[model samples]
Target: MENIAKVCSRLIFLSVICLFFAQAIIADKPDFKYSFGCLDKGDYTSNSTYKANLNHLLSTLTSNTEIDYGFYNSSYGRDPDKVYAIGLCRGDVKPDECRSCLYNTTNFLIQHCPNQKEAMRQDEYCILRYSFCNIFGIMDDDPVYTQHNVNDQSGNLDTYNQDLRTLLDGLRNQAAAGGSLRKLAEAKSTGINNKTQYTLVQCTPDLSQTDCSDCLLSAFGQIPLCCDGKIGAVIFTPSCNFRYEEHTFFGPVADVAPPSTNTSVADIAPPSINTSAAKGNDGNKSQTVIIVGSIIAFVVVVVLIIISCIYLRVRKPREKSESKLINWFIVKKV
Candidate 1:
């Protein structure tokens, strides 16, 4: 009986230790999804010289190209005659992530849409869109595609969307003011109902004021397809993208100031940034859990000690009595 009790206690202890480590791992991780956008139309100008010019322009620029430290751009540089394109990255991604994503997207744009010069790729982290026609600051609803979460988290639609919009808009304002070197913004909002949300918005630096705002608004409208009725979602295009979720997927806001609007890709550029150079939002959930858990752990330890002392204090006399009884019975039998 004593051996069985000891085995049961050992199992219980192991189970509790496993549970604690599992909780810690679950508390610190983030959920990130990926996506891309493509524009299907591109008719190179009929003039041979113009086509050559266009190809040279394209060879020089990629659909989504990393220009400076943390900023990204889309080059209509494909056709110098009619320059129009778009590039964007998330506000929280580090400069290296921004660069790496852009570099990979350059290949993606060329590979996925090789024959079609107008194609674009919209991934979870960045977007690359270019066209023969002027697409800046103008709304293009023709190729708009909305994607939402495959699984529904809850049916609390109204409150979720409202909180998402407010948080996103605030993030937008912050991104717009990011200036010449960097333009990105991220914010978190907790609803009155205690549901928490994280939002991130970003634009390419080359875009004009009106163009930046309009492109973001256009992407925002596509949320119904991406994030509506879900715990998290990302809406993006080659020009701009917005995302919000119950988790903090974004890394960190750069301490670097905004780049100048007119700062061209040329001249004194920003330094190459490392991915770890910036931090992630990490959400408030973990912090709250850790604090509460600490208090609970402390309380549990105190209670366990008290209970153990009480058991020992009570068992000592009883054990002595039991030993005496056993000895007395033995004497009687003898």
Candidate 2:
């Protein structure tokens, strides 16, 4: 009995150690979500100055605390040996996850693309890219990479396509209109058989609205060739990208209020209002009252119109039935 107890205690201790190590290994492991392009633009020797600059630039990418919004663009070195890098994370990704993704993806790209002067790698959460040329603010839609689920959508293709297109188009517009920090939108729509189609669209915030729109539109145009009726798909470009699936694949999004339309003169007044605190407060209160009253009046008018239309519609059907019965009686008498 003493020997048996010793053996059992040993086994339990060993199991606890094994469990701890297993969890550690899992936590440290990188997610191998690899989709990359080692472009044919150019290559550098192992000891080249460009390689050193590239290393330095990429090293700064993940370490910078100022890039909490998830877009990083920076350059190192000068003239012929300069390197430019861009690291972008999905809008819904938290800052720590974004940094971790960029770190892993940068390491993966370095291993895979070696001495290439231009290379781009995309994982599930982020995109890491470095180029010999200036890639900021400019839109590049070529060399689009796409991935899709093997299972095809089991529904009406036309209806599915229409629903996906509508969702993507709206998301594109919303993302394009985003500010310089981040340009991204996620939404869901009911498709064929009432399945909810989840979608995310995004652009590099550096791109102008027109450029972003064009880049996303170009990505949208590739769905036919790449994903067709797949239940899920992701299309990637340097400037913009989009993804869609039948199931939710993104995190919660913070709601953004629509731009207010009350643009009275006082609302746009000069900065001198800070000097006149009492006047400014009064002006703000007046504007608030006017805006609230306007909204109430608009709602009242719309409600009255809707009630009148409903009454007319219901009365019209009854009047038509009564007239038909009267006409039939008159014909019978004749």
Candidate 3:
């Protein structure tokens, strides 16, 4: 009975660890709660054509040479049986990771919303959406989702909020202006009590600068509705997405160290001049000056020698000519 009890205790501990690990993994990735809208545009059996088109489109997205830039949009099949799809990977995600994320997203959509003419699925690293309607170049914010960390921010809430806004605003501008291929930006800032806040913003590359900006601004506007003073939060939409965390979430590149704004004058002040240390420094300086002077003097001496040689060489020719002239004069006198 004791042995059985010990075995059960170990099993319970393993189960607890597994549960924690699963939750951690989920926290790192974006959330996809459910499909936005589902409908049967055609017979459920005939929808195989639509599924084929979707498969082809998704495969093309990851396999395309341009997919590395992390944005792909295309339409497949004909109207009434056609599917328009868009895939966007996080700016910092690797090509392989982007592909994997997109693959999983497509599968998730198909499994959860089968035979639906329109569906959207979002994962941590990427977002994939398909519809019978045109989804390219147009900005859509419908089906917006918001999530926040359970922990409330510590310290002065006002300062934390301000810093968070500033950081996210800067990132939003950068991401909106990222150009035709990619519009994504990430940044970090020190908030209250020296806590660091990280932020990331991204939009589909097809949107114009103005459109991207507007899309992101709309998402930012929802912050108050979802994650006012939370330590972490994410706002996801079909056109744009942004997230913030007390801990770095996107990647190591976004984990920037906060500037030393709190540094005191004493921190950067020059060290006190101990007499002995000062004397040693002076000695080193003198040695450096002496060495520089010796080098200059040697260079001057070498230049002088070269000038003297050149001068003598020219003078020697003149002297030889003069001597020949004198000899010629003597010969004439003879």
Candidate 4:
């Protein structure tokens, strides 16, 4: 019994230690998924001039100095071998993540879309596109790729979709009207069941306002075809991309409050007092609350695991002893 108790205790301790290390490993890694479009305009040979242009363009896009605004566009080589590539990162993505995303995407494009004259890849944090023709300052919405969460919306989907559309429309206009260096917008809205929906809209910075708007609108038109009735979805294309989900998936940025909708102005009114000075204070309070809540949750989980370990250790021996007793009785009778 003493030996079993020691072994069980060691096993439990090792399990808890393993769980901590596993969680740490998972937290350090970023989960990224990407989709790409490859144009069949023409194929290049392994050692062709086009491949050289593509390599040069990708390197330029991912250069350390060119990632400040998280958008880069450049052309390489000449004539038919020329490759025009564009890299655009989500507005709220950190500079390091932006660079990593672009670099990973470049490698993916080369490997998966090999020998293609035109190819584009879209990840959650960034986009990478390369083409033989002039892709700069132009909007191309064709050949879109749409993805949606597997879960369907509950409650009134009409109300949910209406709120989603309104939120995305405002973000679309705001993003398209952005300055030349960056065209991106993120916002949130309250929908049915008091759920918060976060939406991100973005276009390549090289596109003109009109072109960007048109491209986004075209992408929006496909929501019904791909994302209607879903709780979350992403519509991606070479020119633009839009995403929305119930959870706040992005870090804090210059996000606009949702427009005053069917509710009264008083419902959304600001406090009469000057709260600007308290904004930092309020942020600190929120952070403190989150930290405290996390600690509480962690403690609860640890306690539950310990209880489980004790219960298993106590019960396992009883079951084993009962099985041995039954076996011994049967052998004596035989």
- Number of the top TM-score candidate: 4
Q: Which has the higher TM-score value, candidate number 1 or candidate number 4?
A: 4
Shift in Å, residue 241, candidate 2: 1.0
Say which candidate scores most in lDDT.
Answer: 2
Please list the residue runs of candidate 3 whose C-alpha ends up more than 4 Å from where it truly belongs after superposition.
Answer: 1-48, 252-334
Q: What is the C-alpha RMSD of each candidate to the true structure, in Å?
A: 9.5, 26.6, 28.8, 12.5
Q: Which stretches of candidate 2 lie over 4 Å from their true place?
A: 1-33, 254-334
Candidate 4 lDDT (Cα, whole model)? 0.74
Tell me the TM-score of model 3: 0.63
lDDT of 2 by residue, 239-317 (tens): 8889887655666544333323543211121111111111112332354467557656655655665565566667767
lDDT of each: 0.58, 0.75, 0.69, 0.74
Residues 79-190 of candidate 3: C-alpha lDDT, one tens digit per residue:
7767788888777765566778788887777677776777777776778888877777889887788878877888888887787878877887888877555688877777
Between prediction 3 and prediction 4, the one with superior TM-score is 4
**Estimated TM-score for each candidate:** 0.59, 0.66, 0.63, 0.69
Tens digits of lDDT, candidate 1, 215-253: 787788777755667666666555666666665666656
Candidate 4's TM-score reads 0.69
Clashes of each: 20, 0, 1, 0
